[model samples]
Target: MPHSPMEVTRLTATDAARAARVLDEMRASTLGGGRAKLAPRPAIRESWGRMLHNGIDPDHDFRTDLLSRDEVERRRQTSRLRHTLPVLREGLLSLADTAQHIMLVADADGRVLWREGSASVLRKADGQGLGVGADWREETVGTNGIGTPLVSRRPVQVYSSEHFVRALHSWTCTGAPITDPRDGSLLGVVDVSGPLETLHPCTLALVDSVAKLAQARLRDLHLTSLEQLRAVAAPVLARMDGRAVAVDKNGWTAAVTGMPYTNRLALPKSLAPGRCWLPALGLCSVEPLPGGWLIHPTGDPEPPLTAPHILLDVSHPRRWTVTVSGQTGSWTHELTPRHAELLYLLALHRDGRSASTLADDMFGDPARTVTVRAEMSRVRRYLGAFLDHRPYRFTEGAEVEVLLPEAPLDLLPHSVAPGVVRARAAAGGQAWVERAQR
Candidate 1:
């Protein structure tokens, strides 16, 4: 958030209409819904308040200063996203690495979403108008995937000549929007952009790969359903489609059975037990309906549910949420004392610690170093399949550590241009790669 010297001098465009329109479209595309707009100069749709509250306020200098701490926190998060995003990007980039100068995971709006490329590549794309969460389209930002796909609502490969703007004629871009299957809403776009000379016939393939991976990751994370709730200590009842299903480790669903669900129904149907695999949805013990078959999913020594019940060790790499009830003693997990200790250790030191220290700290004896290391890798490997940016990784000559925020973590863009981060003249992003490669 701290403005570099250039930021203090570089004033943003005061195009309220342009900015407002971009914001409106973002919400509609991401949420699969729109805000009611009233016409007047400088007036935004009421729905925008929630989102506007979150963006970096272009108008306020001090707000950026206040948010400086947030950047530091965000930088820490970048490490996590880096793990998964780079992997996701490989699938995307593998589609057509040469023609592709950059790959990005965009939010609902046309913003950069997320970016992966050498710092030089990112800088070049930025000059060409590409960055995490920036509005892009051949029409808006010139021949680019960001806006074009959003407008078209499909996959597109743009050569320099196809650009809506003449200047974009030299840039080749391909993009595909990743949509939410439940509602068929655009979650974001996977785009590739670079010079026309660098263009390849398979650029569209790259777009598809990125889009697929991002969507898959989102699903694993349980971001797909607003109905899906996450709880640390809430009672859980699993349902398939809409019927009750076997609970997960804590209360994640194995399967659900009963009448075919007509609509979104809560768990704990009194009728009869039927079986079906639970898709994914809300999990508060106190749904509009009664509770489902409560199961003890925790190991021995149990985790203390100071707050009722919550889901533990549910599946990931697809989106899911656990809900805890406000009521006390309604839910609990059975964790072995050792498991609880490990969980507590993770909670206490989410920012991370070297594997050596962690092993010694938890094991309290040098005899179990191999066992501890194996366990640490197991933790990473389990999530490696579905989740991106796993909890543990090697740092400083294979010192294993957990990479996360000190507090609750949110998944956003991560992995900035690694070395020699360059400031860019292009508004979307800086050409870090170009400067760095030099």
Candidate 2:
């Protein structure tokens, strides 16, 4: 039986050398196709499996070409992480320096964008190819802090022999992913790394804490931007008549008139001033505002003469989108993870589902109908009448097509919803059967 991750952490902090030896033995036995006296932690074990499947050599260090200096600068300038640098530095740098650990910030793709902290640790990291502009994806560097957290979408710590690659076994690293507060999209990862002797169980918690503070900073900045946009939109919206809304670029509403105010309005990827079909507002005239847009219903019952076609694409591992097409125009909205799961479930059961049923499917608790209903309400605002709420389903006559991932297991990989889990299992089994028959 595997010792729990907590037990491993306690042992590592008190007797790192012994813990390292145990982990090394476990790694060797497992990688050598034999059962070990103890099993690796689930995260480490899963990562090792991926490394084996991807043919990442455990004994060799594979390095990709680092990005050019100019490219690194460009990424820093454009990344939203730049805004939270102060928060990250204030919260983590001093502690990291004192602990002889170097702090690193990597973009969502696992390219190291910033590296700082102890000068000695910086030199050590340089010798190990952990410098700025280096690619640290799991596929590129095997199992480590930065890449693993990006894949797992959570904080992770890799210590000593827990690393899949032998070269990285001498290093200890902890990382936490930072996501955009506005849309819940991943921004990047912040990590603390040092030599194996510096391993500490608290490193993961500290890094995770700082990462959350950075997210809070980003959330504050987003709210400030929304306020500024609201100020600019107030006068424009005040003069407007009949169901109109002023929304920021990300579809966050600043103000609304002649209709119930919604927190957001689903806008298309490419928007312009003229007649456009919006999700909630139906046919609307859209005009650019100073910081956002002014949209009003054009008073047409249906979009021109064509029924809407909806496409829900959950093929991508991290990003999901819903596209609506009509005679007037076509628009696509990137979906948050929860919305993606709900839409996928609805697509699966076109007949419809009760709120309680959806709750049970999503949370494994039938009594959580309130939570399901609230999320569904938000979905309806963006989906408009295409979604029917009596039982909750796509409109009967409308064409609803779902684009799924080529690999069943890749579908909504981050989702823990029971429906998605069951779907993945069923689909994987079916795929295995098909392959066997062929």
Candidate 3:
């Protein structure tokens, strides 16, 4: 039925006639209100054999082999949807520079999580196919991207009339499924809808980019949940993420910070910007830093690279802050909303809160423990980037706390500060977090 080169050769005249006769008779049976079994009924075949005064040719046939287009479409959908998180609505307002319609995120049972973009554009988009609370799966609404991708566990671009819904002929959608890497499960989907005429190859990529950004953010949540890290300061900063038992030269976690959580999580850029701690390398190594332990031929001899065992040595309980450099952003310039959020959080809780406690008191929607750990890490990373007296870098067995800025509201955006709240409950509790209400 699709327009592909994978068609079979045409049937010969005699065969075509026979096919016509079979189909005509089948149609007549239905029209005349008589049931005609297509199987070899002796009388039916005899009648057709006689009616076909012309001899039937064996050459006539129809082609059926296809190039497995389903796989092509399926893989595309899977890849696109794999990592994107649905962008949640924060306030009553929507973001600028997007379709004028609202997009919703839902679980398998069709419960809405988040939705926002352009309300006017969304209303028109709804007419094309999607609508508030409407399911978009192949089973429920047809072979469109969002619902079908969710069902199929992939990214999908349902185009033109491929949709099963007659009301969706004018629509096309590109959708990708969001996934949680810590446990490797489907979180939901992110989809973009627009007119078929405006479709371009970049369209899907944009949706894919958003998904990746969201996934990156999601992964950050996971990292923030890991409250402890093996901060071994050798030639290279080795951040070993084994059980506390495997820490130190003896490989025994004799001293542990009871803030219990997982060890292995993604490394956020804020924590290790220019440096990468390779777990496979066994030995750690530092890079060419600006100027610390410099050995200039003409200048005084610089201090030797700090020893790795310093982290475990009781004589030096505080490991020298390994200055992994090159994190440059809003600190030298203006602060972003996220910058404000991090600064606010750090400012509010000068005393380090446990990763779990931070999730409980600071955020409105609760991320999984893994996600929470990553966000905490992000919170720390962001503070390190902006604040003059950035608090603790990262270590296991203890909570990190930052001293709030003296000018409390300095982190808030001068323009939008009044409209924003200082903090909200985590795990999707605020009025804005509840999508169905919107």
Candidate 4:
């Protein structure tokens, strides 16, 4: 088997020639007969499989058409990744240049949108077709750090011959994926690369750390935007009477009046001025606000207390959907992994859960009520009528059912929320105990 990354790093450090020989053997076997006695590292081998299946030619110097200047500018204007560029450069560019490496940032689609660092490295990169607008997706260019990390959704290092393409064997690259904090959607990847001689085992860790810093900066920007919207909402909500709230375009609650404070309101994909049925607070009149929308509860009488059927499906790897059926009709809402965990927790404890209890469950910290309350507010937007607050709970008349994955371990695969983890552990243990009894 191919040595572990740590072992390879150590070998490269102490016996570079031997390590190189092993890599050469591995590559020769893979390309010539696909019967390499020594396999590459798991990640690299997996990436190679994907590239081969996609019909990528390892010997050919692949280059896809670059984006037009106008299109590139348009992407920069619209991409959230734009806000992270400064953070990435500040964290990486100087060090990368000094180390004879280049720092490159590619969008989710693997299009290199920004590149900088050592001039020599940049020129070498250009020759390798790694310039801005180049498609470096695994299928496009074979396994390299930028595209590989995006596909793996983690930090990855492609060292010398570990790269699937022959042309990339002279270089080493480390990259980490950056995802949106608001949602788990990938924004892009940030990578540091140089000639094979510059391979430093620490590069992957450094890139991963900087990627996290970029995400932190993005979170700060999101919070700042919310604060500004809150400022604009204050005066508007102050004049409102009876249940009204000012919410941003994404339904982040900026201000609320005549009701309990909520973090966000569920909003339709498109907001237009008029009366509409909102999941939370029943029917409401919506009006365009400066940075968001003004929602006013129409004071419609609460529907009869007929038990609504709620089905929480967490079977999918990436998505969770909640289906609600009752007097009006059935509506389904797709939830983020975090929201899925929260809803699952709420369903488990049908009686109710205080903000602090939920915070503790979701984050392992009772003080994280702000985040819990915010997410719950969003949940209410779609299930508001079926939910009740002040120690949030499904309305007493609602019947809740949850659909779990066939394999208990498969539940909420992307969720790191403490509640989901605990649920998984508990279910796994129960399964094991049942097997033991049998």
Query: What is candidate 2's lDDT per residue for 1-438, written digit by digit as tens?
Result: 326567777888778778788788877777776766666665676567557656788888656789999999999999999998999999888877888888899999999999999999898778877789999988899889988888767788898887888988878889999999988888889999887667777788889999999999998998999889888888877887778888988889988888998787777878889987776677888889877888889888874535779999998767889988777667788888899999999999999999999998899999999999999988887786688887999988779899998766457866668888789768762343222223
TM-score of each: 0.37, 0.90, 0.33, 0.71
What stretches of model 1 exceed 4 Å from their correct place?
A: 1-87, 94-100, 137-139, 220-438
- Error of model 3, residue 134, in angstroms: 3.0
1 versus 4: better lDDT goes to: 4
lDDT (tens digit, per residue) of candidate 3 on 286-330? 222221110101122332322211111111111111122221111
Candidate lDDT scores, in order, read 0.39, 0.83, 0.36, 0.78
lDDT of 1 by residue, 1-438 (tens): 212212211211233233324333332332333321312111111112212323423222111012244543464354223334654656765544544476665544454546665456777755644444455532235324655565445576654433434455445567776665332445556677665555555557656766677666655654322224323113333322333333322233333344332222222212233221121322222222222232221222333323232333312211222223332222222232233234334434446545555565565554556666666543332222111123332221221222332111111011111110111112123222122223
Candidate scoring better on lDDT of 3 and 4: 4
Task: Kindly provide the TM-score of model 3 when superposed on the true structure, using C-alpha atoms.
Answer: 0.33
Q: Which stretches of candidate 2 lie over 4 Å from their true place?
A: 304-308, 429-438
What total of clashing residue pairs does each candidate reach?
61, 0, 44, 0
**Candidate 4 lDDT by residue in tens digits, 158-179:** 8888888888888888999898
Name the top TM-score candidate. 2
Residue pairs with clashing backbones, model 4: none
